[model samples]
Target: MKLIRIFFLCLLTTNALIAQTISGFIEDASSGERLIGAAIKFNNQGVISNRYGYFSIKVNVEPVRLMVSYLGFETKEIEYTITKDTSVLIKLHPVQNNLNEVVITSSPKQELSSIDHYTIPLELVKKAPAFLGESDLFKTIQYLPGVQAGNEGTAGINVRGGTPDQNLILLDGVPVYNINHMFGFFSVINPDAVSHVDFMKGSFPAKYGGRLSSIMDIAMKEGNLQSWHGTLSLNPIATRLMVEGPLKKDVSSILVSGRSTWINGLIGLGTLISNSENSTNYGFYDLNVKLNYKLSPKDQLYGSFYTGHDGFRNQFKFDNSVYRFGLSWGNATAALRWNRVWHKHLFSNTTAYYTQYNYNLSQELTSEKRYNATTNSSIKDKGVKIDFDQILSNQNTLKYGAGLVHHTFAPENKSYQNSRMDSTAMNTPVESLEWSTYLEDEYSITNKLKLVAGVHYMGQHVQKSYFHSFQPRISLHANLTSRSKAQFSYNRTAQFLHLLTNSSLGLPTDLWVPAIPNVGPEKAEQWALGYAFQLNDSYSLTSEVYYKNMEGVVEYTDLSAFLSATNIPWYDRVTVGKSRSKGLEVYLNKSRGKTKGWISYTLSKTDRKFASLNEGNWFPFKYDRRNNLAMVITHDFSSSKTLSFNFVYNTGVALTLPTSFYEGALPSNYVHDLNNPLLINYKFYQSLGDMSQRNNFRAPAYHRMDVSYKLTKLKVNGTRSWIFNVYNLYNRQNPYFIYYDQQKLKQFSLLPILPSVTYQREF
Candidate 1:
């Protein structure tokens, strides 16, 4: 037909003569903030920046040259002149003698655009290496490579083999259910108020959903709109303070931070040097806040809040014969956000959130007739979200979102009292409704392939039980040259809450439970395969291979005693299972020269099955570990000294021991008394023992090493620092639990060669 209408009018006149476009937002010229991944480039095409810093591109040429980069910032290059479609706002700069330079160049541009992502850079999570001197971003994400760490100065995490409530975590975008504090040896994020940390682990982009393995967003720190600042810290078990200013300078800003725990005044001065009358106490505290505004030039607004608490107390007296005990736990969150840009290729964000977690316990008794007890548990959430981003040219880009939540669970609530007045109470509250929707796209099918697909849908209602899920995601990349690349991913996740821990020690009497109608929701399906290169210019290397598969998994019932259960009804004691895991991970980063760190490894296997556990076969999965290793190193001996080291090794964890013992008997009509014929009885029996199957045995191979040193000075009203640490530098006695007592076999160890110190100041 006339050469198919002249090949569709020469492809619409060559896309209307080279369609042109460019878009932007990437600030931080001195605290105007914004700058989420930054790394735009122009002719050879590139893009990165989203998570609120926006960027879009589509060009044909007309005086172009644009570059922009980030990592300690400072790398811009501009030229532009694309006639009719453009919008810009670039600004970068902050590399003034970046610690006396030694950077060797290796801009992996945030892993060349995600697929099993990772992005830690808040100054390398505040220069890594810390445990008691605090700096922890979940303990530096457990030293990377498929994560795993929980039990040994905990900061719980266990990605590839899942657990730790299947990882969700979020902070500014709210959703943080007990990110730990004292009991986990600290981790309530306060790496100077944080400002970036991504981590995805297995391509799951469809705007994320309930969690089934990983996702840790976290982003805070939007203060200092151009001046006012403050900081102060001290450690040896906590103390901190922070502040930020400019409540209206560049159109508003605010930030506040707090932390506490002073070893409870050194345990009340060791009970006044052991002159005690019986006493015990513990403590924890946290707080953070943020607010920002910029109501013009396309609008913006934000507000965030966080709160934390932990407490414990015990007392006993001789005079009136009394005893008492108490325990507490906490978490709280809030968020509100806005942000708009409706044009330059549409962008929008809107959110409203609230979260809460709670726990409490108490006990009391008085000598002659009086007793009391109490317990409580809680969880709550209220949410709203809407997100969008579009840009349809230079090879597509889109993202969409929707959300709704309202949950309120209260797994246990009990009360009892005595004194000839009797009383008892039990309360169970559960209410739910959750919803989700998502969409994703990021095409670019050429110039070296790329594709990201998505879809997600979810719905859940409790009480009368209802559930739905549809997740599907996909990823791919290929660029076998120019520094290498190759990736692949697939995901499918679902979770309706479940955390029923029975000790790996991160305690708060863990329990979160949901999913009813015979307990359901909990599913995963992962798959990953990756490779990244870049060997020089300051190294880089990646490697992955994963496999998941899980379904309904939930545990607890082995006669359920999750920390002494009470008043029953936690889905009638849990137990629904099936699990599987597979792994092989490796990472090697180096980032630049004043000596940087990274080196991770993992090789694994996990298993589980349950028709009711054990006899259904499959075992191992008490954090099954086959091999795992980590190493981090840092060195910068000038520009204010520094040194750091961390080492880890694992391959042990899988326990369930008992193996042999016997003697049973008792019960011959209650020791023979059948109508008094020959009333002769003799009874004494009971010794049982014999465990052997589930999680068979293992637990002995762990290693640890840590070291740190830092010093800085230049205080004329500003910097000052000192940090020194040595947590287990060489005292290798790792096992943290095992017992038998009188029949031998005991083990138990928790942190030993400890030494810590910290002090800081900034103004």
Candidate 2:
């Protein structure tokens, strides 16, 4: 028995001696900080570290290379093999130069960072201060070149001289019809629900269709694959909450976020103070929710639902309620995505989604004892899309996709009491459909030359719509040196829908109407060229010039024409026109270790020509501004604190305000006129008129400054630190809009400076 035991112990010792083992401690070479949760891989077997930054793995084959990597860090590989148990330390350098470059994290985890373009990283975007403590996606994007904010508080932006609607906004790959809420005061997107934002401003790939200017792709969080984390915020406008965590260890996860407004309570308080029971009550609220589930490493399913409502009630039961309006709009989207890595260099993401948008309004009267009522209008849209991206090689990449959109315009319900005191009703129904496909390729011809070219073909089948059209685009870039580059781009785009609004205010009455058989689509062709040079690591200079020509544009004729049975042919009520825009943009960026900021200026002109107005002479558009300037700055007080500030100065927007009165004469044949000549109508302010067009009038010069501070890296008990923020520190009155009351015959300007504070915590 002793001899048998000795033989077994010898066999066990031999097996242990032959086993191959590898271990390492990963850390940052610059900071000398251990990189916890760093990934360490070898051949086909690998293991990650615990909180202490130590890892070990056993394999049958000898290790030829060891790769260690972490987010925002340079990847490093060591060439060695472990014949027996061994411990090695690995240090990785920080990629400083490329750290601020745009990254597409929506792609598969393997090579997502490789899909590179000129982008503003989220880290840099976060450094820019916001208004009312609310950080807006579109507002932040305006800091980058090739983008311009339209109006105050509105997320509307004009990219490369394109109309606001020309840019397509996508959420989780689903197209969003309208990206603005609260008349552009806020973006439809809830910042808490978004993980990454990708905006392609210059050269767009073929996979993205339906828009001509640019594409804003917003990606939601895939949930926390590691552990649970949550955030909550309370601000003047609204309160928000979010939660994300792993569903099953490291395999599955889920994410949820929600927000609501307390404006109703504010409205109630105002009513009580006035002590008027008949006064109108106005309030607005919004809600957002999103869910994501990871079925496997190669498959993901996500669903997002949003709903919002606004109402203004003016109760006068004894008499007629003069005006009562309620407007509501929202959408729901569901997407199922399948991602597969065909090879080390090729990755594929296939997605299918359903999207919708809706709007409704109703008005009634209790006075006049007559059933005088009108259901203004309601619009519904349904769509489906498919997108594919192909990463061929390091120098060349391709994208192609297709989609179908169907819009159903509900019949407008109209009722009015005629001279006989009888109510009459009429309805109008409109439906339109569109399908499109595109292909775009980005190629690097040489070390210094890059070219991006693509074409999109769109077909429209309108049961009651207009003609079919296509959009084409191309962009070229040349790296004169490592810090200086030159770029040029040309694009042609079209819009098949129009916004019918008489008031400049971005109100809900700004009806969206599709092109019909008689009315043609609006078209635009734009060209731009720019040059950039870096003086040093702290300062860079950029300049760009552009020109655009627009055709088949329409402007409102009758200021108060109701679009209903009375105006069966709404197209006839619009004036046909053409427009042109030319502009120059110059920017200087200063980025250093402790301080970062940018200064930008724009000089632009816009004009319109119509056959029926000004004898076909070109005139200025109302929104034409000669100059605009913005400055943003950020200072890092310490490793755990930051201060940010923003200032903007812009020439006033143009408007059509009444100037001088004209002389008029009363007809001698009229009963009241005893052969008397009276003052007649006349054109006003011709000498002072800068130009004449939809955007010809300009307001006073505008300027405002805002500031915010953040405190981070604190530990309260076992939880993480908090981020405290304050916006509009000095209370600058930024103009929201201007109103002209015809009855009062006076112009009134509205301005309000708001401030807010919020707290954020991460674990």
Candidate 3:
């Protein structure tokens, strides 16, 4: 006991007496925008940069060599001789003569070998063929190994059997509620204003929470600090513009971007040109703005804002009566952040943010009798958070944070007419409080082994009930050889809110609800094991296997349950169940040279069990697919000419369909005998999808090919490019959905053999 105490004392005293601290920020040399996840190594030990590019570590208090590296950026080495505490700035330049490179990793290393994480380069995705010439961030990720899309040309993604709401999508460290537009046909995020995206499907970090399946952390460009630039782009469906410049040369900068679709505009114009009273319009628009200012070398502030809206209106006029209908949904979010380096060893970031999502519907009719109806549903959150990173020594790093959020939920359903009304809240307008705190440590046990251990505590209070959770996280990494690596991780995630979906169409009518007494919060546990090998200097391969289990998930009993049964409480109408998923994924990539691309494959299974719905039997989840494969290739014929191709194939998704026909029932107002004078003989039949077994029918297998070509010309002062693309080049009429019509099952497809062209100008 005495010797152990003495050794611990010596370990604590060694750093204070013999070592010093060195800290600084890493940034891009040309634009001065901070880089996230940059690596700094000294004597073979290192730490990664934070969200704001701040990094700190303890030195030996003697002359030493420091190395910094980031993907797609040149490596830098500095010779330091300082003996006490000091701070400095390090800048790295872009790689010479290399086009955009997709790293596809989350580890804080110089290699593309991360476990269950991906870093997607925004520019590289722009080179691929897009839907209607609009490059989307969400669609790019759907091509990964373990991700699945719900339908053809839809932006919603299902990760590892989890629902779309299970993903926590953030923009500039702020939460975004609605990620879809045009009834889930396209995503609302502007691709040009984004810098990059970090997607983590396994190994949850300590500072992230409120989701079960994945985390999408998106960052905005900080604008160029040395000059001004602008871009204008046009396609058949939408128009977009972006501008960025230095507000005060070197201290401040601003970026503004906006995009609007013209399909609905043209529809409205056509109706006006014909002087028609009846018209139909549908449109979507989004805006992004960002600002940053440097108060000093150690202090900086940033502000980011985003707003997007989608609206649909249809009206019909006949005689003296008119019917009108409108539906709209959108998301608005803002975040303000400050970064301060308290000392050479500690870095802190403080953030305050606000986010809201809502959908509204109105319908009215005028005639001898008047009818009107409206519904407004919304959810809002206001929160503040502070995170800190402390480098203790060469072997130990500490990370911790705390946050509090205020939530307001309003699920209102009301309809009134000239004579009667049915006004009742779906759930009610309630305010709640949510708070969380976490602590974690990343320790290098040996020169070739590392471990990350953490704990998180969270709680929520709504009405007269309060619920809390305790979760533990762990990760282990080993360098098996100079060219081989392996990793293992475990994560527990919980969600306090739910999306009440009554339709598979991803409509705006979906409602958001909080955890009630009977229905607890949704929880998931996942474990992953991965191995990687460097096939050569140009190619890399990785294989991963994962298992996940989810509990306390709730769903509606029927498609029309929402507002259909007002007498029964909403909570009572939902049924709670559990799910399980397991999968194996493989990926291969080529990262260097004029031609680069990747191939990915996944084999997976998922099922669910509910006592009330499926007769206590386990059945396949909607997204359960036995196989998925994707391959992509990009070739640069020259600097002025580039081409890309993508091919995707996946097993058929499961569906539910009626298998038998039943007899009709007599109408209430009809008699059995046709000769009766008082009434007539008639029959009425009612039928929908049978829910005896969940997802027992499978649709046809899906496969498609896409291609894009870019031709560039150098202008006198800038550059001009023309992009031509084709979607579903083979004209395959793949099944988007299955419907029973005329007593027969039919296949429906939305997009087929589409080709588009876009023009872009940059100055």
Per-residue accuracy of model 1 over 337-433 as CA lDDT, tens digit each: 9989888888889989998888888888888888988877888999988889888866678889899999898877777787877555556578899
Per-residue lDDT tens digits for candidate 3, residues 101-219, read 64344455543235777878776777788877888888878889889987888888889889888999999988888888888878888988988688989888878889999999999
Q: Show model 2 residue runs off by greater than 4 Å.
A: 1-128, 273-275, 279-285, 295-297, 314-324, 342-346, 368-372, 411-428, 464-466, 558-566, 663-696, 716-747
Evaluate model 2: give its lDDT.
Answer: 0.61
Once all C-alphas are superposed, what RMSD does model 2 give against the true structure? 10.2
Query: Could you estimate the TM-score for every candidate?
Result: 0.36, 0.77, 0.94
Off by over 4 Å in 3: 1-18, 61-63, 96-108, 111-113, 272-277, 419-427, 566-568, 670-691
Q: Higher-lDDT candidate among 1 and 2?
A: 1
How does each model score on lDDT? Answer: 0.82, 0.61, 0.84
- Count clashing residue pairs in model 3: 0
Q: Could you give the candidate ranking by TM-score, starting with the highest?
A: 3, 2, 1
